[model samples]
Target: MIKTPSLREHIPKTFADIPETTAYEAGYLVTKNAGWRNVRPVIDKDKCIGCLQCYLYCPEGVIAKDGGKVKIDYDFCKGCGICKKMCKPDAIRMEAEKH
Candidate 1:
């Protein structure tokens, strides 16, 4: 799991609220740039064919197999769109991040 700032300290109002980052948060390329992302990936389970393309292409280690389905960990996903582009079945799509 992504080790984000403790919510018990003071809840982050948005992704931009949390600043400190470790490589464990996202990937090296995106760990400190989470707020810079304008979009986020969301997967359509029915459209997914269990190809694992998203899981393999995801750089943030946020994609995983859960009950034979691809689960996306938004806590660490940097919205880089690698998974969306790698999805042959068009299962994943990037949506505008709502602040």
Candidate 2:
């Protein structure tokens, strides 16, 4: 059976402990195929219960909690539909990214 880290093991205890990523935001970053995604996830605020299932499952760590709402950072998101699949309330939807 596959094993996953527990919530306590996954989340950082403090902001200082958060892992840093320079590849996502660094010089010449705009040239890193920033807008190449054909699809992206959008969260429906009305339906979102802030369950954070999406945030927990996001491999890129681009999803964050803001004002008790779940926010997706499209900049680092790879158009993966994991968030939508994990959302029990069906709050997240994958829509075509508009050029």
Candidate 3:
């Protein structure tokens, strides 16, 4: 039902400066907001065990350690649920977005 461009279309036979490939083509860092996901991660302080698993596995780098507790940054989180599944202590849970 979906169609994607071919790999050859994205890569060139020779090296040259292309405008379309400029974004992250040469190991550059880019930050973009991904807060449009349908769900979000919420951390429970009481249930957290301070293992830091969620922080290490977060793909968006939205999880962090505050003193000894884990905190989630909703602005950049894409709600992929990697943190929720990686949290062995069951501290993080994925809930539907309020809006």
Give the candidate number with the greatest lDDT: 2
- TM-scores for every predicted model: 0.64, 0.67, 0.65
Cα error, residue 82 of model 1, in Å, equals: 0.4
- What TM-score number comes out for model 1? 0.64
Q: What is the lDDT of residue 3 in candidate 1?
A: 83
Model 3 scores a TM of 0.65
Q: Best-fitting candidate, measured by TM-score?
A: 2
lDDT of each: 0.73, 0.74, 0.70
lDDT of 3 by residue, 10-95 (tens): 87443232222212222233555664789988888999987777777777666655656767766677899998899888988888
Candidates in descending lDDT order: 2, 1, 3
**Clash pairs, model 2 backbone:** none
* Per-residue lDDT over 1-99 for candidate 1, one digit per residue giving the tens place of the 0 to 100 score: 988887676965653443333124344444444676789998888998876767766787777665566787676678899998999989888999999
Select the stronger candidate by lDDT from 2 and 3: 2
lDDT of 1 at 45: 88
Model 3 misplaced stretches (Cα beyond 4 Å): 1-32
Name the regions of candidate 1 deviating beyond 4 angstroms.
1-33
